[model samples]
Target: MSHTSTAQKKLLSRVRRIKGQASALETSLEGEPKCISVLQQIAAIKGAVNGLMREVLEDHLRAHLGAPDISQTQRDEEIENVILILKSYLK
Candidate 1:
């Protein structure tokens, strides 16, 4: 099974919540809510996305680099690849 399979329910719940947050933001815009309230919703969405990303990254690290069956050289290569991916992603 894929790494995400283990967390599928939780991830889906998070996504649903993010969607709700987006919907609320849209409704707030229609209702002319305070600027701070809108900003807070935006920040909440950002935090949700970041939390999902962090969970996936941690799962990848544990599945690949932390596997007991993986050789040292393979682990080192995986680490480099992960670092490159992170660098590109961050940019």
Candidate 2:
């Protein structure tokens, strides 16, 4: 099975948790929440998103770039793609 298929359940769980965090953040924003509380929620959401991104990036690197069966050209292409994405993500 593909790496994505193997991790689908875990990834989905993380996504669901992030969704819940977003919903809670929205609700908190709608009420008289303290500034610190709102900031903490925002931080939590950011951390969760970063964690998910890291997981997917690592998987992509391993599955697409590190696979021995693929050609060097293919690996170079994957590296370029990763670089482009990282540049955009960092921005």
Candidate 3:
């Protein structure tokens, strides 16, 4: 199995929590929630997403880049892919 498969359950749990947070934010907006409450929910969702991204990115680095068995060319390709993704994500 792949490395991500090993952590699939944890990842899915995080995604579910994010979905719930989004739903809560939607509900709050539908009602008359305070501005602070909306901001807090948005921040919570963003933090959760960033945490999830960090976890997957770390796993990818370990599995794809840190593996000694892979060729240098393969490692270089993976590094370039990671850099491209990070640039797009940051933007």
| lDDT scores of the candidates, listed in order | 0.89, 0.95, 0.96
lDDT at 61 for candidate 3?
A: 96
Over 12-71, each residue of candidate 2 has an lDDT whose tens digit, in order, gives: 999999999999999999999999999999999999999999999999998899899999
Tens digits of per-residue lDDT for model 3, 28-80: 99999999999999999999999999999999999999998999999999999
Candidate 1 per-residue lDDT over residues 17-62, each given as its tens digit: 9899999999999997999999999999999988877888899899
Sort order, TM-score high to low: 3, 2, 1
Quote the lDDT for 37 in model 2. 100
Candidate 3 weakest ten by summed lDDT: 1-10
Better of 1 and 3 by lDDT: 3
Clash statistics: count for each candidate? 0, 0, 0
lDDT score at residue 12, model 3, on the 0-100 scale: 97
